[model samples]
Target: MTESAEVECVVVGAGAVGLAVARALARAGREVVVLERAGAIGTGISARNSEVIHGGIYYPGGSLKARLCVEGRRMLYTYLDRHGLPHRRCGKLIVANDAAQEAELTRLAERGRANGVEGLTFLTSAEARALEPALRCTSALSSPETGILDAHGFMLSLQGEIEDAGGAIALGSPLIRAEASGRGFALHVGGAAPMRLNARVLVNSAGLSAPAVAARTEGLAPEHVPQAHYAKGNYFSLTGAAPFSRLIYPIPEAAGLGVHLTLDLGGQARFGPDVEWIDPLSTDEIDYAVDARRGDGFYAAIRSYWPALPDGALQPAYAGVRPKLGGPAAASDFVISGPEAHGLAGLVNLFGIESPGLTASLAIADEVAARLSEAA
Candidate 1:
């Protein structure tokens, strides 16, 4: 027989989004318990990626990605300021490599406007070169609100808020199974000390594993769970001093935002995240290795926008896999499934939370809280 405990809410996964959700509920006076399979928090999808604070561009108008990113970016800056977290509004430039690509820049600016992003400025190649002397482009769109932050520090702050409000984050604890209980959920937990938890709510913010978790849960209708796909991106760190003062991006690609230059808080420049679709039945089959041979492709892509890129300057740094709902041919939007969508009361599932996920975390948390409240 499994030991049992009770809580107002049980959140699976301790990624950035999970922590944000936990903090939001705890602040609302709910007794929340966050379960993480890893020994430490943020070891999964949250730990990887570009860590760019998006400026509400690059998403369809009125979509959750656009709305939540715009709202979340503002909330994140405010939260970081109030807490003195490590972040910088260093800005970003979306460049079109040649005159043939100039129309895409115009469309991006128009899209940004539709998405309510502020301060989007169009620039000629010469004008863009003025901002970042080494930048090469036919035209560029400057997004002053786009930036970078210390992702780890941000997660720590969310964890701090959750704990301060009496919420517990149980690392090394995984949700083995979950089923709908009377007006809530019954969760079977796995860890050093296995037990069952009865809670008023269940939130699956498991990031990459969310789809799998939802498929296993007893009450969730299988048809409600979306198919899972992975798009792995590889990053290569620049070997020398940074070439540009701000983040630099080429025109977007079908599978991702494209191979771009992102600067860390310490000002080190790394270019990469070229899209490579991964096909694996289990998460264990996914490999995060940054293949050096892939650097040949990076050199070519990076040189297209920055001709000054020297040969052999690209070094394999890292790789991150984006949890996607669809494949390269068909992109998917952020899926936030509440009781309204699945008819499962007190349960919310988040899927395809990649890219702007770090930027949209707070707003996502707010949306999750609102959904749960409506069910209440």
Candidate 2:
């Protein structure tokens, strides 16, 4: 029998949340170890998506999504500034194309206000277009806090912090399964040499495979975990030139931001993230290839607000899958289940972390740290 490797905490998955957990635990003087399935950290959904740091504007007040997003949004900008990370506090404008949509926009503002997000302003169409001369809108709400950052740079900064705090991140060390042994847990890792990780705490921030990982651990009840659904958003980038200075969006639908337009730190414009439900098929079977025909619907949606947009300029860019917990068009909350929820010990499973996950990552880490501390 192989001997066990001891650690204070073992965080499976080195995505944004996982790395954040490790960094927090290590910063708190806990001996932390991170195991990543990919050859590198942040290679999964962390590296994917629009890299937008969302302002807390969407969820109900007092919800985890609302509280964590607002807190994390503020902390992220500070983190970026501290690390010299590439970012832009480029704001976003949620548009109301017509009178009917204006009510939804108002509701969103109320939602944001309820969540304690300040400076969310309702603007008339003229006021909205004055800021973005190319923009044509009936009404708009400006979220000054919304922004974008170089995701890779941000993640690299996080890795540096984790390592500097005397924590270790092992890439390609996938957690095969886990079983409880005494007060700690034993984890089986997929590698040439089988690893026996004995840790006081286990963090399941495995993103897409979170539920599956939780199911793998011994003594964890299956009914306690929900099935993980893959929500894929396909992006179609605009060809050359800029359309607007800020990120533009229609009212958010349940699954995603709709076919909204989001720009990078650069002034280039790209539209996308049309929501599609991914079935439980092989990863290879679920294609990330963009469908050019999909842009026909996109053109209609964008031109509703920007009427001057020329046709045939839209092009296929990239597609990303969001690990979702709910069905299409269903506004959902972030699920960070701890021992209290499942009556388990030393386990934290993060499920249905979509959208503002990039914004709420730091606050998520704080929640995890508090839970682990309580467990201890």
Candidate 3:
């Protein structure tokens, strides 16, 4: 016999995005319950990331990524400050290795400005070198708003807020299946203790498993379920002291942001996330191991901007897989589908929420809440 319960809202996956969504709904006076497949919160995509607070520079103007990232960055900074959480607006520099790449930097600066990103400055080679003498570039773009934070701390803060608002998170509980029941959703959850939840609202923010979760929904059409692609990113940590104080990035790549260097709150620098697409049957089948040989490619990429990078300086740090909607050559934007998209009154599915997902979490939550409220 399965235990049964009822809730006003159910948020699948207790990642940063899911927790933020739950927090928003809970604060809105809804009885929300978050379900996590893993034994812990944020053990999936949220655990493995650059943890960099993006400056909304790479995305196209008028896109959700641009608007939410810019909006969320401001909100995040304020939230962190108020909560006394650890973070730093240490800033970042997007370096153009040669004259050819300088053109790309100019385009990016324009896009950033159009997206309402603040404090974007173009720097000549001399001006850039003056700030970071170790960097080698023909030109660079300074995004003073770019920063890093304690991602885990932020997620925990969200969890605390949800609890404070009388919401709960059920770890180790996965949404086995979902069916549209009248205007609400009938959710069958599986875990150490299997149970059923009749939720007035359902949000599929399952990260990598988002497509899989949607596939299991009875009323959702197959056309609405996009193919899930896993792009594994491997990081290599610096063996010695970091030469630069700020985050250093080469121009963006098609699959990812390239082998950019990001600093942790402790000021330790790590470079990574070189795109390696894998065909995994499920998220459980994917391996998170960082292949040491991949570090071979990191040398040339890092050397382009920091020629002083020494041999054997990089060690296998970790690996993270982005839940991508497209392949290696194609790019995709964040898809937050609601009732308007699929005619599902109380369901919202999030797809391809990579990169700035962490930075845009709170804003994403706000959007999800508004969509559900309108449907209600």
How would you encode candidate 3's per-residue C-alpha lDDT over 26-64 as one tens digit per residue? 999999999998988999999999999999999988899
- Against the true structure, what is each candidate's TM-score? 0.98, 0.97, 0.99
Query: What local lDDT does model 3 show for residue 90?
Result: 93
lDDT of 1 by residue, 1-376 (tens): 7899989999998988999999999999999999999999898888887889999999998799999999999999999999999999999999997666788888889999999999999888899999999988888999999989999999999999999999999998988899886668889999999999999899999999999899988978899889999999999999899999999999998989889999999999998798898888788688999889988888888888899999888889999999989888987889999989998889999999997898999999999999999889
- Which parts of model 1 are misplaced by more than 4 Å? none
Stretches of model 2 off by over 4 angstroms after superposition? 1-3, 282-285
The order of the candidates by TM-score, greatest first, is: 3, 1, 2
The 10 consecutive residues of candidate 3 with the worst lDDT sum are 97-106
Tens-place lDDT digits, model 2, residues 1-376? 6556889899998888888888999999999999987888898788778999999998888889999999999999999998789999889999987777899999999999998887899999889978998888889999999999988887788888999999999887888899875586888887655678888889999887787788888888888778777887878877788778899989877677678888887777888788778796644366778888888888888887778878788888888888777767456688988888976688888988877888889889999999879977
Error of 1 at 332 (Å): 0.9
Q: Please give the lDDT score at residue 114 for candidate 2.
A: 90
Clashing pairs in 1: none
Compared to the true structure, candidate 1 yields what TM-score? Answer: 0.98
List the lowest-lDDT window of 10 residues for candidate 2.
280-289
After superposition, the stretches of candidate 3 with alpha carbons farther than 4 Å from their true spots are none
